[model samples]
Target: MRPEKIAEANEIDARVAGALYMILADYNGMDMPTTNELKKSLRENGASFNVVKNRMLNRALSEDASALLKGQTAMIYGDGDVVEVAKVIKKFTAAKKKPVIKGGFVEGKSISAEDVVELSKLPSKDVLRAMLLGTLQAPCSQLVGVMNQKVASLVYVLSAVIDKKEQEA
Candidate 1:
């Protein structure tokens, strides 16, 4: 390859690294076609995927490369929100009898394949938010009931006292 093309490829590698950083943190390398299909599946779900040379990617990340995804060199790439990428990977991979989520990294932290699957199992943000709201409302509902009961008891007690006083008068 020409020097300029090599440089361009390196630039592409860096981009792939950044994209992969947000996607697969580490991987258990798959066949070329499988990787391609993973990319296609992700793309259909609104995430883009890429396969990049290891050396170029390592150079691109400098010192922050995650060990899970680093060394020997090679990577699968995906892009979009990290959670979305994770969701896509988990969904397609789960559809198969055997899934390939090797393990991966995000920012600088290494993550495991099991971790990825676990993350996929998490309820969506909206669902979590709703659950929190329900929890918050539960306490408020209990408080409302307590206040109503206290007020009712106070009214009943005062009414009894007045009736007793009227009888004595």
Candidate 2:
């Protein structure tokens, strides 16, 4: 490759490396339309899919990133939710299993292909956040309920006492 082309490729790789997470996969036998559709879907979900030269990716990323470059390697990268990206990849791969996730990096740590699958199984960020909010609010909600019952009981007891006094009079 010419120097200018190499520089442009390096720039692209650098941007991909800056993503929050990356999924390395094999895209050996996928048709162009399928590949384009996958790329489109990924882009819509905030991930950019690229068929990169292994050498270029290695140069742009860490030494460990090179481990996943054995087969026809492609990268899915973005600053969006990693789990969401993994879920998209998981769904796409389920339909056509060519671009199997090999491995990738998340938060600067390398993760195995199995890790990516497990990540896909996890709920999305919003769902997880809502679950946490529910959990945190549970105790507060119970406390409010108990306090309301206490106030109601006090009111009932005071009303009964007043009625008894009236009867005595």
Candidate 3:
């Protein structure tokens, strides 16, 4: 390989290694402004987008990941939330109808394009964590309420007994 090609491949490799997840797509018909818009959105979501040659991608990515590489491939990758990145891509696709999803690897496992869409549909990490916390807290809260109710009932019974004794006296 030429020196420039080697450098490019190294760069791709570095990006892949650094990212927690990557999504591949066919960005064939996307114009410059549209691509720029997508890039901007992805950047805001903590991902970077790049158009890479299939051969270079193949050289950089693993065997399973390389299988998705064919024809006008662009890679979107980030160290941030994978779901957020997928949401950005899905939103862009819904609006522009270009850069169709191919497939990608997340945390070293290859996933289908449909999986990427499903991921986009999911709540973000913080949301999921909050849901889990709520679920866990519900039972504890209920238990506390039940205990408090028993104590209140006891207090009411004692008060009623005191009133009856005073009336009898």
The deviation in Å at residue 36 for candidate 2 is: 1.3
lDDT of 1: 0.63
TM-scores of all predicted structures:
0.58, 0.91, 0.94
Give a tens-digit lDDT track for model 2, residues 64-93: 566688978888888999998899899999
Pairs in steric clash, model 2: none
Best by lDDT: 3
**Each candidate: what lDDT?**
0.63, 0.88, 0.92
Per-candidate clashes come to 7, 0, 0
Order of models, best TM-score first: 3, 2, 1
Arrange candidates, best lDDT first: 3, 2, 1
| Candidate 3 residue 9 C-alpha distance from true site, Å | 1.6
Compose the digit string of candidate 3's lDDT tens values, residues 1-169: 8999889989999999998998899999999999999999999989999999998888787765556887899999999999999988888899999889999989998889999999999999999999999999999999999999999999999999999999999
Give the C-alpha miss distance for residue 46 in model 2, angstroms: 0.7
Superposition-based RMSD of candidate 1 using all C-alpha atoms, in angstroms: 5.2
